[model samples]
Target: MKDENIKTAARLLLGTGLIFAGISHLTFARKDFKAQVPDWVPLKIDDTVVYSGIAEITLGGALVLAPKKYKATTGKIAAAFFTAIFPGNISQYVNKRSAFGLDTDGKRFARLFFQPVLVYWALKSTGNVK
Candidate 1:
Protein backbone atom coordinates (compact mmCIF):
# COMPACT_ATOMS: atom_id res chain seq x y z
CA MET A 1 0.00 0.00 0.00
CA LYS A 2 1.00 3.61 -0.49
CA ASP A 3 1.06 4.23 3.23
CA GLU A 4 3.38 1.30 3.83
CA ASN A 5 5.71 2.51 1.16
CA ILE A 6 5.83 5.93 2.72
CA LYS A 7 6.60 4.47 6.11
CA THR A 8 9.37 2.41 4.60
CA ALA A 9 10.97 5.46 3.06
CA ALA A 10 10.69 7.46 6.24
CA ARG A 11 12.20 4.66 8.26
CA LEU A 12 15.14 4.43 5.94
CA LEU A 13 15.68 8.15 6.15
CA LEU A 14 15.57 8.15 9.92
CA GLY A 15 18.02 5.28 10.05
CA THR A 16 20.41 7.05 7.72
CA GLY A 17 20.15 10.26 9.67
CA LEU A 18 20.93 8.46 12.88
CA ILE A 19 23.97 6.86 11.33
CA PHE A 20 25.22 10.21 10.17
CA ALA A 21 24.65 11.79 13.56
CA GLY A 22 26.42 8.95 15.29
CA ILE A 23 29.41 9.44 13.05
CA SER A 24 29.44 13.11 13.87
CA HIS A 25 29.33 12.40 17.57
CA LEU A 26 32.54 10.39 17.22
CA THR A 27 34.33 12.62 14.77
CA PHE A 28 33.78 16.12 13.44
CA ALA A 29 31.07 17.06 15.88
CA ARG A 30 32.49 15.41 18.96
CA LYS A 31 33.08 18.68 20.80
CA ASP A 32 29.66 19.95 19.85
CA PHE A 33 28.11 16.77 21.20
CA LYS A 34 29.94 17.15 24.49
CA ALA A 35 28.06 20.38 24.98
CA GLN A 36 24.90 18.35 25.37
CA VAL A 37 26.17 16.05 28.10
CA PRO A 38 24.81 17.12 31.45
CA ASP A 39 27.29 18.00 34.15
CA TRP A 40 25.53 15.55 36.46
CA VAL A 41 26.49 12.60 34.34
CA PRO A 42 29.40 10.80 35.96
CA LEU A 43 31.31 9.75 32.88
CA LYS A 44 33.87 11.94 31.21
CA ILE A 45 32.05 14.04 28.63
CA ASP A 46 34.09 12.56 25.82
CA ASP A 47 33.33 9.04 26.97
CA THR A 48 29.64 9.75 27.13
CA VAL A 49 29.73 11.16 23.67
CA VAL A 50 31.55 8.13 22.34
CA TYR A 51 29.23 5.67 24.04
CA SER A 52 26.14 7.45 22.84
CA GLY A 53 27.59 7.63 19.39
CA ILE A 54 27.99 3.88 19.36
CA ALA A 55 24.46 3.45 20.61
CA GLU A 56 23.10 5.64 17.89
CA ILE A 57 24.99 3.73 15.26
CA THR A 58 23.68 0.42 16.55
CA LEU A 59 20.11 1.65 16.79
CA GLY A 60 20.32 3.10 13.30
CA GLY A 61 21.58 -0.19 11.93
CA ALA A 62 18.79 -2.04 13.68
CA LEU A 63 16.19 0.27 12.25
CA VAL A 64 17.48 -0.21 8.75
CA LEU A 65 18.21 -3.94 8.81
CA ALA A 66 15.68 -5.41 11.22
CA PRO A 67 13.51 -8.01 9.61
CA LYS A 68 9.81 -7.26 9.12
CA LYS A 69 8.81 -9.50 12.02
CA TYR A 70 11.20 -7.67 14.31
CA LYS A 71 10.40 -4.18 13.16
CA ALA A 72 8.07 -3.38 16.03
CA THR A 73 10.60 -4.45 18.61
CA THR A 74 13.29 -2.39 16.90
CA GLY A 75 10.89 0.51 16.82
CA LYS A 76 10.26 0.27 20.54
CA ILE A 77 13.99 0.23 21.22
CA ALA A 78 14.55 3.21 18.98
CA ALA A 79 11.75 5.12 20.65
CA ALA A 80 13.20 4.38 24.07
CA PHE A 81 16.61 5.51 22.88
CA PHE A 82 15.17 8.81 21.76
CA THR A 83 13.46 9.21 25.10
CA ALA A 84 16.68 8.45 26.97
CA ILE A 85 18.68 11.10 25.15
CA PHE A 86 16.14 13.86 25.76
CA PRO A 87 17.92 15.03 28.87
CA GLY A 88 20.97 15.89 26.81
CA ASN A 89 18.82 18.27 24.84
CA ILE A 90 17.52 19.71 28.07
CA SER A 91 21.08 20.06 29.35
CA GLN A 92 22.10 21.92 26.25
CA TYR A 93 19.31 24.40 26.86
CA VAL A 94 19.68 24.78 30.60
CA ASN A 95 23.45 25.12 30.62
CA LYS A 96 23.48 27.46 27.66
CA ARG A 97 25.84 25.13 25.85
CA SER A 98 25.24 25.84 22.23
CA ALA A 99 25.63 23.14 19.62
CA PHE A 100 24.08 22.31 16.29
CA GLY A 101 23.24 25.99 15.85
CA LEU A 102 20.94 26.07 18.89
CA ASP A 103 22.89 29.09 20.11
CA THR A 104 20.08 30.91 21.84
CA ASP A 105 17.83 29.89 24.70
CA GLY A 106 14.77 30.13 22.50
CA LYS A 107 16.35 27.97 19.84
CA ARG A 108 17.54 25.41 22.37
CA PHE A 109 14.13 25.38 24.03
CA ALA A 110 12.47 24.89 20.68
CA ARG A 111 14.84 22.04 19.88
CA LEU A 112 13.50 20.24 22.92
CA PHE A 113 10.24 19.70 21.12
CA PHE A 114 11.87 17.66 18.36
CA GLN A 115 12.72 14.67 20.60
CA PRO A 116 9.14 13.52 20.79
CA VAL A 117 8.85 13.79 17.04
CA LEU A 118 11.82 11.43 16.70
CA VAL A 119 10.14 9.02 19.08
CA TYR A 120 6.96 9.15 17.06
CA TRP A 121 8.89 8.75 13.85
CA ALA A 122 10.65 5.62 15.11
CA LEU A 123 7.38 4.04 16.13
CA LYS A 124 5.34 5.05 13.12
CA SER A 125 7.98 4.22 10.57
CA THR A 126 8.27 0.70 11.92
CA GLY A 127 4.51 0.15 12.01
CA ASN A 128 4.33 0.15 15.78
CA VAL A 129 1.57 2.73 15.47
CA LYS A 130 -1.34 3.26 13.16
Candidate 2:
Protein backbone atom coordinates (compact mmCIF):
# COMPACT_ATOMS: atom_id res chain seq x y z
CA MET A 1 0.00 0.00 0.00
CA LYS A 2 2.81 2.37 0.79
CA ASP A 3 4.43 1.57 -2.50
CA GLU A 4 1.20 2.31 -4.30
CA ASN A 5 0.95 5.65 -2.59
CA ILE A 6 4.47 6.51 -3.59
CA LYS A 7 3.76 5.58 -7.18
CA THR A 8 0.64 7.71 -7.14
CA ALA A 9 2.55 10.70 -5.88
CA ALA A 10 5.27 10.24 -8.43
CA ARG A 11 2.78 9.89 -11.24
CA LEU A 12 0.97 13.06 -10.25
CA LEU A 13 4.21 14.97 -9.98
CA LEU A 14 5.42 13.82 -13.35
CA GLY A 15 2.07 14.65 -14.93
CA THR A 16 1.99 18.12 -13.48
CA GLY A 17 5.54 18.77 -14.60
CA LEU A 18 4.78 17.67 -18.14
CA ILE A 19 1.73 19.92 -18.26
CA PHE A 20 3.77 22.90 -17.14
CA ALA A 21 6.49 22.11 -19.65
CA GLY A 22 3.92 21.83 -22.44
CA ILE A 23 2.52 25.22 -21.64
CA SER A 24 5.98 26.72 -21.63
CA HIS A 25 6.71 25.18 -25.00
CA LEU A 26 3.75 27.01 -26.50
CA THR A 27 4.36 30.28 -24.76
CA PHE A 28 7.37 31.57 -22.84
CA ALA A 29 9.77 28.79 -23.72
CA ARG A 30 8.85 28.40 -27.36
CA LYS A 31 11.95 30.12 -28.61
CA ASP A 32 14.18 28.30 -26.21
CA PHE A 33 12.71 24.98 -27.20
CA LYS A 34 13.54 25.62 -30.83
CA ALA A 35 17.19 25.54 -29.94
CA GLN A 36 16.79 21.81 -29.25
CA VAL A 37 15.26 20.87 -32.56
CA PRO A 38 17.63 18.92 -34.73
CA ASP A 39 18.61 20.34 -38.10
CA TRP A 40 17.71 17.05 -39.76
CA VAL A 41 14.04 17.37 -38.91
CA PRO A 42 12.13 18.48 -42.01
CA LEU A 43 9.47 20.56 -40.31
CA LYS A 44 9.97 24.16 -39.35
CA ILE A 45 11.42 24.51 -35.85
CA ASP A 46 8.38 26.42 -34.64
CA ASP A 47 6.02 23.77 -35.91
CA THR A 48 7.95 20.99 -34.24
CA VAL A 49 7.92 22.83 -30.96
CA VAL A 50 4.21 23.47 -31.19
CA TYR A 51 3.41 19.92 -32.10
CA SER A 52 5.57 18.55 -29.30
CA GLY A 53 3.93 20.92 -26.88
CA ILE A 54 0.54 19.64 -27.83
CA ALA A 55 1.73 16.09 -27.44
CA GLU A 56 3.14 16.77 -24.02
CA ILE A 57 -0.13 18.32 -22.90
CA THR A 58 -2.08 15.34 -24.12
CA LEU A 59 0.27 12.78 -22.56
CA GLY A 60 0.34 14.67 -19.31
CA GLY A 61 -3.43 14.63 -19.09
CA ALA A 62 -3.41 10.94 -19.72
CA LEU A 63 -0.91 10.29 -16.99
CA VAL A 64 -2.89 12.33 -14.53
CA LEU A 65 -6.27 10.93 -15.32
CA ALA A 66 -5.83 7.48 -16.71
CA PRO A 67 -7.71 4.73 -14.86
CA LYS A 68 -5.84 1.87 -13.21
CA LYS A 69 -6.41 -0.41 -16.15
CA TYR A 70 -4.88 2.07 -18.51
CA LYS A 71 -2.02 3.31 -16.40
CA ALA A 72 0.49 0.81 -17.72
CA THR A 73 -0.32 1.62 -21.32
CA THR A 74 -0.17 5.33 -20.61
CA GLY A 75 3.19 4.87 -18.94
CA LYS A 76 4.51 2.99 -21.93
CA ILE A 77 3.36 5.72 -24.26
CA ALA A 78 4.90 8.39 -22.06
CA ALA A 79 8.18 6.50 -22.01
CA ALA A 80 8.12 6.35 -25.79
CA PHE A 81 7.44 10.05 -25.95
CA PHE A 82 10.44 10.74 -23.75
CA THR A 83 12.56 8.53 -25.95
CA ALA A 84 11.33 10.31 -29.04
CA ILE A 85 12.43 13.69 -27.79
CA PHE A 86 15.87 12.50 -26.74
CA PRO A 87 17.42 13.54 -30.00
CA GLY A 88 16.50 17.11 -29.27
CA ASN A 89 18.58 16.89 -26.14
CA ILE A 90 21.38 15.52 -28.25
CA SER A 91 20.94 18.36 -30.71
CA GLN A 92 21.29 20.89 -27.95
CA TYR A 93 24.53 19.30 -26.87
CA VAL A 94 25.96 18.75 -30.35
CA ASN A 95 24.97 22.12 -31.79
CA LYS A 96 26.04 24.09 -28.73
CA ARG A 97 22.64 25.70 -28.42
CA SER A 98 22.26 27.35 -25.08
CA ALA A 99 18.84 27.36 -23.50
CA PHE A 100 17.55 26.62 -20.04
CA GLY A 101 20.93 27.77 -18.79
CA LEU A 102 22.68 24.81 -20.37
CA ASP A 103 25.38 27.16 -21.61
CA THR A 104 28.29 24.84 -21.00
CA ASP A 105 29.11 21.68 -22.90
CA GLY A 106 29.28 19.77 -19.64
CA LYS A 107 25.85 20.99 -18.66
CA ARG A 108 24.29 19.90 -21.93
CA PHE A 109 26.02 16.56 -21.67
CA ALA A 110 24.66 16.12 -18.18
CA ARG A 111 21.16 16.95 -19.38
CA LEU A 112 21.32 14.03 -21.78
CA PHE A 113 21.35 11.58 -18.89
CA PHE A 114 18.10 12.94 -17.49
CA GLN A 115 16.00 11.72 -20.39
CA PRO A 116 16.42 8.09 -19.41
CA VAL A 117 15.47 8.93 -15.87
CA LEU A 118 12.27 10.49 -17.16
CA VAL A 119 11.48 7.33 -19.09
CA TYR A 120 12.05 5.26 -16.00
CA TRP A 121 9.97 7.65 -13.96
CA ALA A 122 7.03 7.32 -16.30
CA LEU A 123 7.19 3.56 -16.13
CA LYS A 124 7.81 3.16 -12.45
CA SER A 125 5.34 5.82 -11.43
CA THR A 126 2.57 4.03 -13.25
CA GLY A 127 3.50 0.61 -11.82
CA ASN A 128 4.87 -0.61 -15.11
CA VAL A 129 7.85 -1.78 -13.12
CA LYS A 130 8.09 -3.55 -9.80
Candidate 3:
Protein backbone atom coordinates (compact mmCIF):
# COMPACT_ATOMS: atom_id res chain seq x y z
CA MET A 1 0.00 0.00 0.00
CA LYS A 2 1.00 3.62 -0.42
CA ASP A 3 2.73 5.43 2.39
CA GLU A 4 -0.07 7.93 2.83
CA ASN A 5 -2.57 5.16 3.16
CA ILE A 6 -0.38 3.45 5.69
CA LYS A 7 -0.05 6.63 7.71
CA THR A 8 -3.74 7.30 7.61
CA ALA A 9 -4.49 3.80 8.75
CA ALA A 10 -1.99 4.08 11.56
CA ARG A 11 -3.33 7.46 12.60
CA LEU A 12 -6.84 6.14 12.65
CA LEU A 13 -5.84 3.08 14.61
CA LEU A 14 -3.78 4.90 17.18
CA GLY A 15 -6.18 7.78 17.51
CA THR A 16 -9.34 5.74 17.85
CA GLY A 17 -7.62 3.26 20.14
CA LEU A 18 -6.48 6.00 22.46
CA ILE A 19 -9.97 7.48 22.51
CA PHE A 20 -11.37 4.18 23.69
CA ALA A 21 -8.57 3.87 26.19
CA GLY A 22 -9.31 7.32 27.55
CA ILE A 23 -12.94 6.38 27.93
CA SER A 24 -11.99 3.24 29.79
CA HIS A 25 -9.53 5.07 31.99
CA LEU A 26 -12.04 7.75 32.80
CA THR A 27 -14.62 5.15 33.66
CA PHE A 28 -12.38 2.70 35.54
CA ALA A 29 -8.82 3.82 36.18
CA ARG A 30 -9.90 6.92 38.02
CA LYS A 31 -8.93 6.06 41.59
CA ASP A 32 -5.95 3.91 40.65
CA PHE A 33 -4.44 6.45 38.33
CA LYS A 34 -5.03 9.18 40.86
CA ALA A 35 -3.20 7.24 43.52
CA GLN A 36 -0.23 6.88 41.24
CA VAL A 37 0.05 10.59 40.60
CA PRO A 38 3.48 11.91 41.50
CA ASP A 39 3.91 13.76 44.76
CA TRP A 40 6.41 16.32 43.56
CA VAL A 41 3.71 18.15 41.67
CA PRO A 42 1.97 20.72 43.77
CA LEU A 43 -1.43 20.78 42.10
CA LYS A 44 -2.69 17.44 43.26
CA ILE A 45 -6.29 18.21 42.68
CA ASP A 46 -8.78 15.38 42.56
CA ASP A 47 -9.89 16.13 39.01
CA THR A 48 -6.65 15.76 37.11
CA VAL A 49 -7.07 12.14 36.17
CA VAL A 50 -10.47 12.59 34.62
CA TYR A 51 -9.40 15.83 32.99
CA SER A 52 -6.38 14.17 31.50
CA GLY A 53 -8.59 11.41 30.23
CA ILE A 54 -10.76 13.99 28.51
CA ALA A 55 -7.69 15.55 27.00
CA GLU A 56 -6.58 12.19 25.70
CA ILE A 57 -9.95 11.60 24.13
CA THR A 58 -9.87 15.02 22.49
CA LEU A 59 -6.41 14.46 21.10
CA GLY A 60 -7.28 11.02 19.83
CA GLY A 61 -10.32 12.38 18.06
CA ALA A 62 -8.28 15.13 16.46
CA LEU A 63 -5.71 12.65 15.26
CA VAL A 64 -8.30 10.29 13.84
CA LEU A 65 -10.22 12.98 12.02
CA ALA A 66 -7.68 15.64 11.23
CA PRO A 67 -8.34 17.66 8.15
CA LYS A 68 -5.63 18.30 5.59
CA LYS A 69 -3.72 21.24 6.96
CA TYR A 70 -0.19 22.36 7.88
CA LYS A 71 1.27 19.03 6.86
CA ALA A 72 0.80 16.39 9.53
CA THR A 73 -0.36 18.81 12.15
CA THR A 74 -2.42 16.17 13.87
CA GLY A 75 0.45 13.73 14.00
CA LYS A 76 2.76 16.37 15.38
CA ILE A 77 0.27 17.28 18.07
CA ALA A 78 -0.15 13.64 18.99
CA ALA A 79 3.62 13.16 19.15
CA ALA A 80 4.07 16.18 21.36
CA PHE A 81 1.36 14.99 23.69
CA PHE A 82 3.12 11.66 24.01
CA THR A 83 6.30 13.50 24.85
CA ALA A 84 4.46 15.50 27.45
CA ILE A 85 3.26 12.32 29.14
CA PHE A 86 6.66 10.66 29.17
CA PRO A 87 7.28 11.78 32.72
CA GLY A 88 4.17 10.00 33.96
CA ASN A 89 5.46 6.80 32.47
CA ILE A 90 8.71 7.33 34.31
CA SER A 91 6.83 7.84 37.56
CA GLN A 92 4.98 4.60 37.02
CA TYR A 93 8.25 2.81 36.41
CA VAL A 94 9.85 4.26 39.52
CA ASN A 95 6.85 3.37 41.64
CA LYS A 96 6.56 -0.10 40.11
CA ARG A 97 2.88 0.48 39.60
CA SER A 98 0.51 0.42 36.69
CA ALA A 99 -1.52 3.39 35.53
CA PHE A 100 -4.74 2.94 33.61
CA GLY A 101 -3.98 -0.78 33.55
CA LEU A 102 -0.88 -0.19 31.46
CA ASP A 103 2.06 -2.36 32.50
CA THR A 104 4.72 -0.69 34.59
CA ASP A 105 8.08 -2.41 34.64
CA GLY A 106 11.02 -2.82 32.31
CA LYS A 107 8.61 -3.55 29.50
CA ARG A 108 6.50 -0.52 30.30
CA PHE A 109 9.48 1.77 30.43
CA ALA A 110 10.53 0.56 27.01
CA ARG A 111 7.06 1.07 25.64
CA LEU A 112 7.04 4.60 27.01
CA PHE A 113 9.88 5.47 24.68
CA PHE A 114 8.05 4.27 21.59
CA GLN A 115 5.03 6.58 21.64
CA PRO A 116 7.09 9.28 19.99
CA VAL A 117 8.11 6.84 17.31
CA LEU A 118 4.49 6.02 16.63
CA VAL A 119 3.82 9.71 16.13
CA TYR A 120 6.79 10.07 13.85
CA TRP A 121 5.76 7.01 11.89
CA ALA A 122 2.32 8.40 11.37
CA LEU A 123 3.75 11.70 10.20
CA LYS A 124 6.35 10.09 8.00
CA SER A 125 3.74 7.97 6.31
CA THR A 126 2.42 11.18 4.86
CA GLY A 127 5.81 11.52 3.11
CA ASN A 128 5.21 15.23 2.55
CA VAL A 129 4.83 16.40 6.10
CA LYS A 130 7.70 18.03 7.89
Q: Estimate each model's TM-score.
A: 0.98, 0.99, 0.77
Q: Which residue pairs clash in candidate 1?
A: none
Model 2 bad stretches (over 4 Å): none
Q: What is the C-alpha lDDT profile of model 3 across 24-66, one tens digit per residue?
A: 6588667766644666656653566677788889988887766
Ranking of all candidate structures by their lDDT, best first: 2, 1, 3
lDDT (Cα, 0-100) at 107 in candidate 1: 99
Error of 3 at 15 (Å): 1.0
Which candidate leads the pack in TM-score? 2
lDDT of each: 0.95, 0.96, 0.69
RMSD of 3: 2.9
Worst 10 residues of 1 by lDDT: 58-67
lDDT tens digits by residue: candidate 1, 21-98: 999999999999999999999999999999999999988998899889999999999999999999999999999998
Estimate the overall C-alpha local distance difference test score of candidate 2: 0.96
**Candidate order by TM-score, highest to lowest?**
2, 1, 3
Model 3, stretches more than 4 Å misplaced? 99-104, 125-130
Residue 8 CA displacement from its true place in model 3, Å: 0.8
